[model samples]
Target: MVSNMAGGQPPWHGTEPDAPLGALEVYAEQAHGYLGASGDQLGKLAGLLRPPVLESWLRSLRGRVDPMDALDDRGLRGADLRRYLQAHPIAALMPLIDKLLVEDTAATGLMVVVADQFGRVLSVQGNDERVAAAAEVGLRAGDDLSERRIGTNAIGLVVRTGRAAWIHGPEHFLYRMRQITGAAAPVHDPDGRLVGVLMIAGGVRVARPEILALVKATATAAEMDLLLTAMRPGQRDAARRDAGRPQPAARLGLDVLGLGQPQLSIADRRIPLSQRQAEILLLLAEHPEGLGADHLALLLDDSDLDNGTIRAAMSRLRAVVGPAVFGSRPYRLHVPVATDVEALRAALDSGDVDSALRLHAGPVLPRSTAPGIIDIRDELRVRLRIAVLKSGDPGVLRRWTSGAEGRDDAAAWTAYRATADPETALYAQIEAKIRVLDRRMGADATRMQRFGA
Candidate 1:
């Protein structure tokens, strides 16, 4: 019957009356005894505890998790943090979660938490007093509630099992958490992929079996709302675009333009790529004829790595990108993959400077130092800069100069000075920068002459 509860249906429904409050109390007491028992006594106590709670406890013991350890609240911060908060598919569920769970339970000794698929808490909404109390235990936005991080909590369990879970009092792996009860249900996207978990936690004063139904119903409503929103006219086009046409394998897209970390998008999932993986994929895409392990290692700037090391890396990449996407014999992409670097090159080749600028995300894996990657990265930067300067487009020049890449670019600044309107403030700024550059170049020339270069 865990499945019944997971499906948003109470197991007791259409059967005998619900388990009495006394039953939960007894379960909590037994769980406490099990928690306090020594290694030898644990074997005897196991038979008395509920199967799910007992299994969870065993897992905690196997993992060697401490029952008194403080909770972890670390996660994404700054712009990277903002991006996840804004672009996550579960973002649409916030209002509904607030209305049904947070507001409804305010001042009732309860708190509502919403977390991403990885069990990193995205938002926490609840009664002010209860929220403060929860924060004392590190329960708040950006907190990681994964079972690996916090042991056997309901939010982490729901995320791990994709099932609704209710953990009361001593069922919690952490002794400090035993004063509360938690009920959580997983939220799925319209495509039926698990997106996040919605959890309600309350002090012992509000513990009740009915809380399970409330959490499940709220999750169901949030999912329904997500589906309905996706069906709306404005959202339908985007949904369709995201779904794409069915292909033999998911298309891979890489963005490695500038200073930002490179990201790989496989269908709807966008994952960050390690520098080595990015270099390998970029090389593979550049050489559709494929590369042997030796050549690939050289291209990766690691000549000492043997074939086995390369194979191990490829295996790890395969786990993320899928086996169908990578071919053996000669390592290369077996399926079609698109990258922003290629998009920019194509745009520039076709004389579409605007499109090229738009496609240029940042720099080609700016942190990468591999010889091949450096060549490609430098080539792309030079080509784009030359094209932008030659195009005589003020809009393009302005965009380039305004960004981090062009902030001190002498060529871009000179181009802007030549093309910009004299009446404009930008022209004055460019003029000042040109003077600064001229003086610097003059100083460099003097140094070279004085040093007999």
Candidate 2:
């Protein structure tokens, strides 16, 4: 590995040809200049880079004269580079790329070029014969071969379309392109920005569908690495968006357990949910407490039924909700999946606030209007409303509790009326509220920072 440890090196300075061009690209050429070669080493480096006609040809291409015209210009400036290096550390991806090339020597026979989000070459890897051949046509590591320069190649087309693309055989726009087939796929950051492009090039004989699949796979692998490295747990999904895959909808605990009725959205999609199942889900979601059979039966207006009948309802409810909620416990439903209450409890118990915050997506149950579940729902409303007061910041809480003001106030007053001793359960409620408010405030700050507000 070339050592560009000093401050003035190019981004690719100390990196091996297979390594990514991360922060090192921003420094002046002198930084990387040292690693480029001196005396006999210069000849060896030149042989690998394949200078002369190749460099001259690249210099003539359109969009070939800017700072990014050369691969060395892809590194960000001081602050931007710091931000980038913090997340997109070259250390993680470079080793993997090197291993891929070394292990897949036969596959590496094809010209492989890696570029920054802006289409500037970051690195290139190829076997000797292919390197020489590509050099003849002005394609080498760190060269500006964007579509704007060479016109309609895989790299350029993928960049333009933000999708995987192939420019095979005669599809090349340039007159000198008859020698190869290339496939390029977009690589994205957690934000779905075009962070990089990965391309594979080979002669027509190797232009099979599998070859394109390999290229796309490489791009996807690269993106997953970037996302895992950069994102805090929640932001990882945003990175996957570049694949154009819809996220599986957020699984409310009941849905995960198949205990709720499915309602059709505006798309007229039917979601199947039984009335009893829906009632139970809404009730649990409304009241964090496990509802006793007697309580449930009363609220359900099924007083005429015997205890055995109520027990049957409770048994059915338990089966539908899945065993994960609570293990043979009576009357208390505890969805195994973390809710705000559980997350706060975890944070309090374990002192891992990030873990707690990550687990809590919203209030335990969100936005249901089941009339039969109203009594339990009111309890949940009061608990959460008190939680808001204690926490002091309602950030996303307001969104969660939106339009439930009447119910929430009613619940608060009802709770006050039920317990004559004002001090009862007061500490627990205060603690929950304090934690919730703090969380909301932090979330708000995060949203503001993301939007530059």
Candidate 3:
């Protein structure tokens, strides 16, 4: 609790159980009850809470976070937290934070929280009592406070929008958090990429307008310090090293599906790859155990392809992505790589045919006939086809029969004919298309028989 606010507490302020609730807190409580209430209840939130808070509340609801439930979600700990902190660029800025935010807040009994870009609490500092109170509710170092877990909060809001935010009193989504107030700001590096968030919090301080401003200013100073550190000749190497590695900020995804040239996505940037490079990446993604150059060469081609060619390709691929993502000896991805194929499979597994179909572009790589790629392409094609056939939904069937991959698939058309109303003109169209395909196949067979030398 904020035992002391420097100046006297406002008339509306209430920390004890006996004290009357602040007007804003009372309204905020009403807003919480309105969650899942009909129409204007959602609309009415705008009149009650700030736009940011309302938006965050809606987002938290969508993420399936229950407002009344408190989370003890402390996953980032032990060796993992240590490694993450060591690799994180913000670890070097700790001294500056201590001087600027931590030391000054010592008297206020306000806790200073530093969260990584993903909203995992890295450190929590304050008076011993305040620190102990924070830990009891799992707001300790290594605990996840991201929207994905604890939902609407100051640190999570900053993480989501890359902007400063403040949540006061009942503005917090979790019931246990209503007694606290927080203001958080995004802390970025020299390149303007968000590395983490800096936050300050205390007992339900309802009207501390200066908190947001102070956090933002501190964040700006931290960014400037990062710039200065990068500018220094002696510290430049460290900065460069951090730049080469993926920060807690960057979101990585590999786009290998569809007919468009395959691309590797690093945060917002997409780096297009050569067909061979894409093929190599796809194969590597499939085989997480790591493939030797010789084995990878074979998967890339049916016949003998030299290992030196694979090494050269790997080198080029490493340069395109960062060298940090790759590992030698057997050659594998060091980081978790999410792909479009995996997304499709996830949707299918969850019975979300609509999303799965929407996600399906063309084949995994329509033009690629590399031995391993062919197997993968056929497997995905079969999986999608089977899913479409099983789902007797006419909309799904029509969608399948309409796509370039599914157009030639007779089985899909047959399934469509079985499920769809035969009275429609679409049924006649399918009949004609199927006949044409059959005749074409027959003619190809005749040609093959004639050419049997």
Candidate 4:
């Protein structure tokens, strides 16, 4: 592919994993330097916004359009570009462009043009002495390359084909393109859709391997910038949209069964139950098959509460908690009732990330006066944490802890982990004790909100 350039073969059709186009070496070196100096700061920002916003910002500032027309095309302003680029400058690309021009005397007569997805040039760079004659045609960056302008050049053709193209000398399809060489490549979004093009247009003799390679490399880095930004909001919204399809109601007995902690209202009737009465109703609700004393004891967290005590609890609970406390048959919790676990899951599956996170007010289980329900609560909270992570909204965590008046070290550590930053892990280890304290406090908070404390 390298040797066939003069005879009209396309520069190697596409990139090889290890061997990037030659000019790419300079850009790659710059990328490494930038990453090292800032720990990939731009990459971090890219991870927080959408692709379109990041790419448009880069083209105007780093690409350096004369009047910032690309920014205009992208619905951005010159001032905004100035401030954003100041904050997130493309340090690597700028000097690399300078080096490419200075190294090749023949190429010094050339210029580089960077364009957006629509192919309007955002920047142009070339030595004044080398490009003296070519400047007459308004070929500087920020010009549109439609049929009315410098027609049929590499920039326009790449935009048209959505592929890399080389228009050397007279091969340019336009009558006005007699003096230069252009090697262009298309830039794509994270999804691999075309978003822009990068091209090096210069004197025909300098249309060498390095120039083509550099253009391709810059475009790739810029494309990476675009992709990382989309992960912030779009990724989560797309996921939610995909998961929002309706689901059939859960199986009756499998999902949940129990009288709520507060006696549930039924037909305006008020029923009061003794502790034993409520315990029996809860045990019956927990299992589809009526539970025997051994299994009931295990579920109730009262292995020592003898079957007789349970029998008495069941009787009193039935009288008030159910139809009648201890009325001949013991009270039973019903199948249709919603357990905390089931309620949380339903909210999440319905795409309510906020609601799901909110439901987890505390640790799953607290040290309980009633051990059986406490175990269930503990298990429920574990599930809620997982659901929050999968929900993909960092804000949800913030809202969940909004009411906390003090720092919750464990929660803070978890938030840091959710961000996947290295610093948070170290902090988490140093504050291990805080995890227990936070859990205790979170439990209290959740109980107050959910169970009226």
> Best by TM-score, which number?
3
Taking the tens digit of each residue's C-alpha lDDT, what string does model 1 give over 1-453? 122112232222211113343554455465566655677767744544455666777777765567778655345445434435554657667778888888888777678888888777777777787777877776667666677556788887887789888777766777777767778889887898898998888766445557778888999998999788657785446536544331333456777777777778754668888878888888997877899988888878745779998999999887666656778889977765667776566556545576678888787888887888988988998889888878777778889988888776777777778887899988898888767866877756534432434
Candidate 3 lDDT tens digits, 324-357: 7768889887765667776666456444565579
Query: Any residue pairs clashing in model 1, and if so which?
Result: 257-362, 257-363, 257-364, 258-362, 258-363
372: Cα error in model 3, Å: 21
Q: After superposition, how far is residue 305 of candidate 3 from its true place, in Å?
A: 21
Better of 2 and 3 by lDDT: 3
> What are the lDDT scores of the predictions, listed in order?
0.72, 0.46, 0.74, 0.46
TM-score of each: 0.51, 0.33, 0.52, 0.31
User: Count of backbone clashes for each model?
Assistant: 5, 18, 0, 21
**lDDT per residue as tens, model 4, 17-86:** 1222342322222222332233345454243212322243234233222221221231223543222222
lDDT of 2 by residue, 220-337 (tens): 7777887665555554564244221112322232331122333312111234445655555555544555666656566566344466876776667555443444432345544322
Tell me how many residue pairs clash in candidate 3. 0
Q: List the residue pairs that clash in candidate 3.
A: none
Instruction: Single out the weakest 10-residue window by summed lDDT for candidate 1.
Output: 8-17
> What lDDT does candidate 2 reach at residue 222?
76
- Pick by TM-score: 2 or 4, better one: 2
The local distance difference test score of model 4 is 0.46
Residue 245, model 3: lDDT of 42
Model 3 spans > 4 angstroms off: 1-21, 40-43, 205-207, 233-453
Could you tell me the lDDT of residue 95 within candidate 3?
90
